[model samples]
Target: MEGFTLILLYLALPSLLFSAVKQILTWRKSLGSKPQFPGPRQFPLLGRVHDLPRYSLWLKFKEWADIYGPIYYTRVIDQTFIIVSDEKIAEELLVKRGHIYSGRPQIRSLIRHKEGPTYSALMDRHDIWKAQRKWAHAAVAEAYKHHFYGHVEREMRRYLGLLLLDPSRFLDYTREYCGRVMSRLAWDDATQGRANGDSADTTLHCMSVSGPITNTITPLWHLPAFANPWYRYEVRREREQRDWWLSNFRLAKDRMRRGELPGDTWAYRYFEQVKKEGNGDLNQTEEQEVFASCMIGFLNLVGVVTISGPLKFFLMAMGLHPEWQKKAQAEIDKVCGGRMPTIQDYAALPTVRACMKETVRWRSGVPLGVPHQAERDDEYRGVKIKKGTVVLACEWALNRVPSRYPDGDHFRPERWLEPGWPTYQEPLTRYPNFREGQAMHSFGWGRRTCLGQNLVDDETFVFAAAVLWAFDLAPKVCPRTGEPIPIDTQATNSHVILEPSPYKLDIKVRNAERGGQVLEGYREVMGELRL
Candidate 1:
């Protein structure tokens, strides 16, 4: 018995020793011998986690950029932050050498889970991610060019007709219109069927699955023990809803297989093609990659969450600046010949595009570009970036940099008209938000740029032009004081995207002539759509 015990003890000791040695080796490798970047000194283990500002990390990064220069480094816990506040640095890392830097960071429970990767944005060098992005781009192109506009025109007319009947619920009607546009782009011909008094449960299921439930739930894992568990009925309900949606997606796939439902939407088409190409008998790895592609499209379709927030903000801007609305209306009237502006009329009215661009730059949809990670050791002017370090290019700061835009804090669309603006303000103009004519990093940088950029731009123009041409947006009045309440542009919230806080507005038809023009234009477009 003693001999057996001794042998067991000896084996356990060596095993423990080996684990310690392995851990030390890993720690040393991660904290490599490369010289550290010059920045705030942090505690040995904690790093600069505590030093991040209370309000906006992007603004704080701007302040640091001014002091630390463009290329700077900071650390939080075990994670390293490499901030490229300069456009030149962004181009160098994100655009020039994208192969080394355009990868996403691998988050903990966020990406590795039983339900599959919840946050597609956090995938790092997963070939599945690449396949997914490729499929997504193709799907978005098909959706915009082939599927979306018909339903969009129909929804817009429906909202306008509703407004003509009763303008009191204009805001609700607008929200519904935006929702329908997004829903149709996501679901295909089935969505049109839904508009004809059919149930939208399947359609809604497809959408609500892409909700940021993981983001909302993950923080609970960090809660202190003995505290009331944060996992509530609400969280469970959301999870169930997500599962229900995923199951419906599977059912949708089954329907496609049986030829009961055509593979019409991007999701259906991609899945159908994958099955066809893979001979309907893929290995587990290929199946995972195929699913990942569908997931990417799913997230892309839910982009309405991103757009709705900005739309609300733009609505507030119109309400606050009635004069701006009046000017926009005037431009629309002139450009459309008193008719609602079409895609054909977009280029002739440059100011409208300029205003839209300014609105996006002044208050962007995503303040922080999706976080990219270093695939290998790298340096930007001696700023050491070890492998797997998460790097973020703060577009919000880059957009607001005074050097990039003279009087950067103010909103001025005329700057876009000045030819010299591009020469002096090349960085700002190069970004998608500021230059409506060109794609920019407002969607993202490198391989992961938003696939829905073209779709969103097209829809924004159609909806915005229609809104301006049809109505005169004005501020809501205080019943007691009979005075207009103004909007706060900076009143925005951030999770993964920037969104405006909910606010009220007053909307009224421009005039009977303008209303008739809008109706006629919509009818003509609707007839073209055959809806």
Candidate 2:
């Protein structure tokens, strides 16, 4: 009887294990028998979900891209995602075949308005999106043609004023300066009436924090409330903030209707147009649709919202590497002599431009960037790609690839001066200037690339050059240990944006007399602009 039992147990165990293996193979076969991308093999129901990295997903994507080529699919649970890391593949899918690849996937939040449609980042690709993009294009183009220079001048003056006033408040000064600059561009003034009765600076304060919360914490909002309690609070806070922003939107719309075009706010202009149309050119359906989709605050806020991460990253990079700052400052000083750097100064200040370019390359503010969704079925390198696939481009990985930048990890601006760079040999682009030959996808690739890249380009140069000229930065030393406090160039806070972990530094005035130069210089310029 014991012998019989042992033989029976062995037979049953083998059969059970075989069944499990067969079940997994059957599941894979059921998932569209087309050649599966060479990903970590899946379990019966789990797929390759467990293989995904929890954070720093871009790193994992780069690893996978190397093993599986540019357009490969990985499944999480049952959902499959495609990663497009190669420039040529991204261009083909995100640009050439964009009409099919342009549609963003339908996330739960996009369709949450049970009764009526909702306004969200994940709206469908339709006429509304086209119109919204058109409005944004027109608004930015207008600013470029007539108002961008004025905003740039005002920003330069503000930066100088803040630096001159108290360099101790450098962080605050930088934040406020950037906020006010975008505020003027979007709202025509730095009043920040969005804060209700709060201080004029409140809007800027909100602008500063919003970037981190949205860019880093937003993904966490997807976790189940029970599994991740932090998301529960984030959802509550996000709702409250959304309500607050909506109220401000309504107020701004009202003021624009009253013909109170204060400074150079793009919202005021867009709002004025919506009111003038008065449901005539567009029907009630169109009016509400347009309003819901392309409200001025909704559109213009994206500009201010995206700026903080890139700007902060730029500041921290300059602060950490004083040598790079010194070189850039020297170049600017040589070119401008006593004058401030301007758009024309771009050609003469290659080192300064290289610093900006290297900053973007070294640590892209938005490392993974906003994900792009494929609209239809496609093939990449003869492999089948299904419709409605979500694709991510690893700009961080692209920038740091050993092949592209030989010693990929170091922060060396002189690398750009290497024999082959600035020649457009690589299919990928760099930042500040984006032509076919001089492509920089830091803003992004294809149609939906960042609209505010131009604005950011102007602001980044001015701020970096001006701050370095005014201050000499070094790492703060530990009093007891006699060692420098370690700084994190990569200690990123991931929200909808990425920011370096806040760290300490010792900054001395470059010239004792010029301590107030940033502010004093601004006052003089502001005096002229006020008239």
Candidate 3:
């Protein structure tokens, strides 16, 4: 009996010691210096865990930003959070000190990539992450050099066809429009030029699963297996994700084996560009390499899947603010005449570009920008940011920073035109440009920022110019009252992406000449594709 008791004590000693050491450290931290940033008052041990809500977490983050300054923080147990609602602070930490502030946190509960390569942006700050980002940029540049405008025009033509046939389905068609455009650009319709539903389904699942945890201010994502309720959910999701990747990868690769895919497709670049960068040591297995490549391609789709976010916001903006719509149309008319506008006219269509930028700012797609981790202990404004601390840019709050956009919630495209505003620019042709390193906060910040931003910019700018040029967008009329029903900003999805609930838009072709031009473009492209 004594021997048994001794064995049990010996077995429990390490855990007991760990608990004691942890308690001692917490006590010391409480008694000693802490991150000097102001935030919601926290409770002992649990920190600000009580402040997090289950839904619309970004709204809460924004509220905190208003209440507790732009740069604030919260702690959840041992984990630390630093929320940056100010653009200047984001630039300071995420840009100037990017080398120290670019690490990804340990999200073991959400991503199960222990045996494989994870998504490029989600990867820890490592050689592979750097290599993948480099390849992504190179691949996008290569695609643009070869067939950039081709894909946009093809998808744009089909979008016009669908919209003309059924204007009531504008929002649905918008989602499909962006999805299919990116789908083709990623794999060149290897699934026979059709939109890949698998990518959408898997992406939706992955985002939905991670959204709850990732979108929160006090991320309890570091909890161990026994204490985590999301573990089983993550496991199931992880398996589905892996299965989806393998199957899609096999299909794309099988087509490539048969020379069905064109040389400009991402599949070709995955092998020629992404894989060619390394000595084949980045992945663990053939499966891992397949996942890594598929994730690269999958990421291409995910960004566009949410492209609907900005578009939905644009539609709402158009409905709520018709004066801006008129301005955009006038610009398109001046630049494009009776024909639909293309990327070539971008220099002359500053109003259209400004309208597009406004949608993202008015209601950002990623409100709580994906949290960036610190690779080392860093000090900012005399505050100590411990190593491994998770930092959030919080775009929703950043755009609303009192100093940046005084009337943050309102939609005003003219802000980009006024020299008094921060977004203001000179030379209408050049200032409304989607140049990175500016304070847009749309593409994110630092070394970990998106490398495929130009591709998105091209697709969105052309879509905006063409849509406003081709049709007049307004709000639906109330049948009984004869007043235009106000468009709602409430989002449809549960995830962080603020996609507007399907709303009615009053869309009508402005004139016959533009209508004919749209049909001509659609017929010419669809007939050539044989779809």
Candidate 4:
């Protein structure tokens, strides 16, 4: 609140009020002519914003879906939004007609550099987005598969080592583990990786919430730097973030030059490919450098936030439903024999894989996934949708649609393992894969789907399997109450990513023999994979 800014706002307030009223009148005039989409009652100016709950927003959307029949309309102020909770409609619009629905809401806070937009997620559908995305995908394609698996396994082993050092820090260790692993995957960083991760988490969290202005409104970003403290803070953070990641970018490039990092490392290989794609002259342009850094930066954000989410949920699932945990461990033991589980055992341990997928399905990372903007006017099921309407694929509601998954409340892995359930598929080895964008709608849809899901799948599965194999999870017992604390599945995270509320896990080695084997196996692998 600045004196000059306030004076200007007040001066324009009367005209702004007039425009708002005019917009409302126009909307009301058209209400009767168009097929009114079923949804909560909209107010005079606030739309449905007044009724929106502060937490568990997906639940509220699901409740509305139940009342309004899958598709519904809601608005915040003058901005209209379509909440699509039905898989078929979501698929039809977000996937089938993706060309019209792949655009993202252009938030004013995120800036564009020479390479492209600050973040790929915020960039609307275009050639630059498509090209950057193509390179992103190619960076993780077949040539990099073996390196990907190795990165996952090596990092998982280190995570388990830290867990052995202190079991009480499961949540902290999981978060750090993801940060370190993604950093390694991003740029082969053995130094200052954690710092890079911290900056990424903070930077993306700001991006997701649009920084301090999110709590206020978008107009705050329009104020002069001296007039807006939030804008000043954002500018400061962006400069720091750019410098931090640019250093990592240079380090990875240096490592490649000095032959310190393996040729197979993601950082090494990706840069080489980019150079090849640019016809052997990288030019080292501002766009090239920033694009390279942000590619890795985005990876850091995605892995540290979203990847940690499912693991937290998996831990919670084990506490709430120990039966599935037992089955998973039993499968791991059978598959690995006496040795500790490895990525190679991934296929053989279908129950272990099922547990991981079930937790993700049971509790999606982003319940109301990244919003997609309607690029043009469209109609669906006889209801007209206006161009520029923000469309959200309600993943939570879609996954819990009674007809699709009847046992939605429980953490049951059998749905993925056995037939007769809608989620089931043949060949247990590959059926639960998260890379199938068409089959798995939790991540995202069509052209805008999350990249590097293979990284998430392989890395997360290895860690989840290792945790299940190495330890037994139960709700921590309260000494004073003399009862095990009840695990609340409804606990949630406030950020864009959805994870279980922090809870202490009662973890223990299944047996002394297996515990020793776990440590010994990790030591051997650590020796081989030490960077």
Best by TM-score: 4
**Model 4 residue 487 lDDT score:** 68
Q: In model 1, what are the clashing residue pairs, if there are any?
A: 432-440
Cα displacement (Å) at residue 121, model 1: 3.3
Against the true structure, whose lDDT is highest?
A: 4
Put down candidate 4 lDDT per residue, 1-531, tens digits, no spaces: 443546545544554476488677877878767786888888875677656664677888899998998888987656788998888888899999998998887554555432354567667877767766786778777534674747666777766766776888898778777777777667766434456556655764565542344332444455557656756777788778777777778778777667676665557767787667763534487767876777666656666777877888888888778788888878887787676577777678888778888888888888887889989998887888878898998888887887788778767788888988887887887777777622478778888888768777777778888888788888899989979887677787545676678787788878888678667766865766433
Per-model TM values vs. the true structure: 0.76, 0.78, 0.85, 0.90
lDDT of 2 by residue, 1-531 (tens): 223434433434544455457557756776855666665555654455456543555667777777877567775543467776667777887778777666555333222311222332345566655666677777776776653756665666666665556655655555556556665666554555223213222222322223222222223324345634443544564455455545555555566656665535676665557558774232235445335433454444555545555666666777778788878788777777655566656556667656666777777766675567766777776776677667777776667656566666677776664456543232222323422234366677677666665676666766666666666777778999989888877676543355455766667667756655555667676654432
- lDDT on C-alpha atoms for all candidate structures: 0.58, 0.58, 0.70, 0.73
Q: How many residue pairs of model 4 clash at the backbone?
A: 0
lDDT of 1 by residue, 163-233 (tens): 66676666555555555565545443323322311112222222221222212122223433332122243
TM-score of 2: 0.78
Model 1 — which ten-residue stretch has the worst lDDT? 196-205
Residue-level lDDT for 163 in candidate 3: 85
lDDT for 171 (candidate 3) = 74
